[model samples]
Target: MAKKVIPLTNTQVKQAKAQDKEYILSDGDGLQLKIKTTGSKTWVFKYSKPFTKKRSNIGFGVYPEVSLAQAREKRKNARELLAQDIDPKTYKDEQQLKQQEIHSNTLQVVAENWFSIKQSSISPNYAKDIWRSMELHIFPSLGKYPVASLTAPVVIAVLKKVAKEGNLETVRRLAQRLNEVMTFAVNTGLIHANSLSGIRAAFEKPAVKHMATIKPEELPELMQTLNASNLQIVTRALIEWQLHTMTRSNESAKAEWSEIDLDKKLWIIPAERMKMKREHVIPLTKQMISILSVLSSFKRPYCPYLFPSNRDPKKHINTETVNKVLRRIGYHNRLVAHGFRALASTTLNEQEFNPDVIEAALAHVDKNTVRKAYNRAEYLKHRTELMTWWSEHIEECAKGSLSVTASVVNAKFG
Candidate 1:
């Protein structure tokens, strides 16, 4: 016959005194209060391994820290695990490992790790901006959560809060960053799936605000203002180069003398420096060459940039320098440095210039893969003609001889 068991009570447990050696007071169903000679008491669950039938004792916790009722609950849970053929101690170890993993794989920890890998491939300024955005916007609410526990609803809620502040652009960028980090976690086996995938649909689409630009007819007045303004000579030159080339502000500001070929009448912007990750060739007009000639005369010794910073010759001019010039000349909000590209595209397209040639001049990526592969420079001849006409047209505008009827049809090119 099996031995009868008796349950323990709080009063009996409190009255029970420690002996010279360790001893156990049974509370029935494998729950026991263990008393040590050092006057300490612990709650332990005595169970048998399901397959091996080996006895094991797993500590619930020290007594009083773990009340009798709490210890009974833990003992019941461990008994359930043993009945399911899982060793209680092994289950406890597994739970501990899972908790450790949760601690280590938090959203901020994983995001920072992912950022560390990504920072090497992107520009320093761009990387810093990405990290700054996350720190200000994302980390506060979600950083401490385990990445595995993050769900779409939780992420969307956080983003909506950011959107509520009228920072829709930041919301979009942060959503993209979140998706990237989640995808990284998925790829690295830290997550089962990317919870942020397709979450952008939940956000309101931010209104597109094209950079401010002036009408084509406004160019003559703008050019006259630029010419008559008493801004620094270098700033004035930077503005002229931006309008003449229609390059991105940063591209023009960071121009290197080595990229220009006065003999070839071309500027070959390398792939690394270009936004499209493809090399671009700009066919220089005589006016463009003259501007470069003047810039070359002022070039500092051992400096490589065409527009070196006034304070630091080793660095290029600030990317915002030309925009600031426009603002100082009272064109703020009415026009910006990037407006030149839109101005050129609009004017040339309206005049029925070959769209392909204009697009090539802008260095825009062609959507057709085969055409992009074969015809990256296909419209060079036409683009050369277009650039020459464009420069002369700019000169006519500056001289106030240009009318709305002015077109490239009358210009000569080879």
Candidate 2:
């Protein structure tokens, strides 16, 4: 044990240097001498705890920082905390309580606010998709987990389960949504960083797939088979646009007439309505342009959507309508409308286009931050050529199917 001393100085240092475990300082009354240890010289009140006057260490930091003069002042503050029965070491929690009392957002309550802020920036369909993923995959198990605890391991485990369940597409989409949500949390000062920041290292992505597109050779038969079925023309056309434009099914279904500029030969999907959150400019092939011109009479050019629902003219087409049509055409279990996007990606790659060009045409988000940080260019030239070829392939298949149907009908009549 050492006697504690106040205001270390040249004279005091000389005297204290001779021995360890020796500290000297006067008590608050300035009458009693204080004693401390060299190894751990924690300050303690010989009296009761701060709020109750029960004796305990009244932490006043270490020796030099809390001089004899300062330590006594802290002792008085400890007495103040004592009057309220609050522990001195628990001061940090008190400050946090104060922060909360002032209405600062915490990890526990920011998700819904984050959702509301983002909904308008995303397509209503995408907003719906995000909610579904959150509700099913995350909300039940993790909705209450502090956002701060959503480390890469936790997120990876969730996504890996989805991938293992043969829902690889959903695994990727969920990862994307998680990344966006945490990013919002960061921008709003809720958490310091995105929880999915190192997600790539935490989980291996499922095998990259070329779209399981029906082959051009197989497509003619499939098309003929589909054409003769009882499918709504709008639903059929919705699926038709998906193939011709190589666009995502939801994108085609939710198309707004106002987004198309026939004179410019472009269809500009606003960033807020797109998954990538960047406006995409797609060149329209002559065939696609012609299809729009014909449908334009039935769809007012200034209406809410190019494919507005017949049942609700002001609303965009239903997200599931095209898929229902596919299921009815007997491709339900075998092929999904979403699979069509992959199909185009796969088929076009086999035709020898560069990989990046094919990806951009499909509106895949850039996973490479370095590329996004530096490159400002998009794959316009390749997408133009890509879309043109895609339209030709679809139209050719539809014609083959029409020919087959005509032949069948003629035989039936005879």
Candidate 3:
């Protein structure tokens, strides 16, 4: 025989008072309102595990907060689970864990995790730039969303906004990073696929603008203007050294005293510093040696960098310092610091220097892996000769007497 069961009503639950001992008011089908001696009222669903027949109580919530109607609805759902042989408490726990997983696998959280794993492999400067890009573009909009919730349309909207702002290059880079983060999420099982994998073609392509450079005939005027500028002697020498060696602005700016060999007339840049991640040997010409000698005379005794910063002798000059100098000389977009490489490559090739030697001097990696491995020091002698001729040619260009007839160039280098 079973005790008579009456469904709970809001009026009865509200008027119920706690007694000396805790007691339960049953509403049938395992739903009960528990009144504690402390005057607390809670709604609980009592049930038995299907396999073991072990009794378990699952709290729906506190009464008054979870009204009679809401408590009854919760109990009905729990009964459905029990009928299917599922423990309601276990089901609740599994649901909570799923919610926790969704929160943990958010786009921003997973992107940061991926960045931590990748930062160790890249340069500190490069890593800083990568983080800056994300902070400026990606995190604010999509950070809180779970990686699985990010769709192709959602990502395209973000990138399209950046492209519309005329920062197409930033858009391109952000697209690449967004793809990388989403791909990381997929690889880590946070999502099923990378939604941004094919999103690049949807944005506008940025126009290409090559670095501005002077024509060969204009080198004399440009050199004279640089010499006559009110720039400091050290800065002037740094510019001259760059022109003579044809090194990138950062390579010239970050140069160290130890990398130079005056005796051998060489500058050996380490693998860590070289853009190609391999050591490069520059054959220093007489003019380059002269510029280095002048710089050495001004070197601070405690500074290890060849071109120490003016404000802080312990640190190298700002990587933009040389470019700023170029801009200061009224050549802002007309010529840039990196333009010297183009100037050299163009003039040297025009003078019939061997293209392979010129490319090797530029420290460009050979595309073919087998050739790259064998040709790391290829055409060393020819490059040395080319540098000497280039130095002499620069002097002639400065003197306004450089004659470049095809026959003259062919006979001289051939």
Per-candidate total of colliding backbone pairs: 0, 21, 0
Q: Give the per-residue Cα lDDT of candidate 3 at 132.
A: 91
Worst 10 residues of 3 by lDDT: 401-410
Per-residue C-alpha lDDT of model 3 across residues 1-414, encoded as one tens digit per residue: 888898877788999998999999988888999999988999988889889999889999997899988998998999899899988899999999987998778888998999998787777888899999888888888888888788889988887788888999898888889888988988888878787798889887778889999898888887777655777666776777777788888789899999998887899998788776778888988777766766766587789898888899899888888789989988888899889889999999999977777777787753243244335355556778988888777777656322222112333422
Candidate 3 overall lDDT versus native = 0.81
At residue 228, give the lDDT of candidate 1. Answer: 61
Question: Which residue runs does candidate 1 get wrong by more than 4 Å?
Answer: 1-17, 27-31, 37-40, 47-55, 63-87, 151-161, 196-203, 366-377, 400-414
TM-score of 3: 0.75
**Alpha carbon lDDT of residue 94, candidate 1?**
94
**Error in Å for residue 410 of model 2:** 14
277-308, model 2: which lDDT tens digit per residue?
A: 77777889876775575456457644667677
Q: Could you give candidate 1's per-residue lDDT for residues 92-198 as a string of tens digits?
A: 89989988987789999999999999887776778899999999988999999899999889989999998999989899899999999999999988888987888
Off by over 4 Å in 2: 1-107, 116-121, 128-212, 301-304, 365-382, 400-414
TM-score on alpha carbons, each prediction:
0.82, 0.58, 0.75
**Candidate 2 positional error at 88, Å:** 7.3
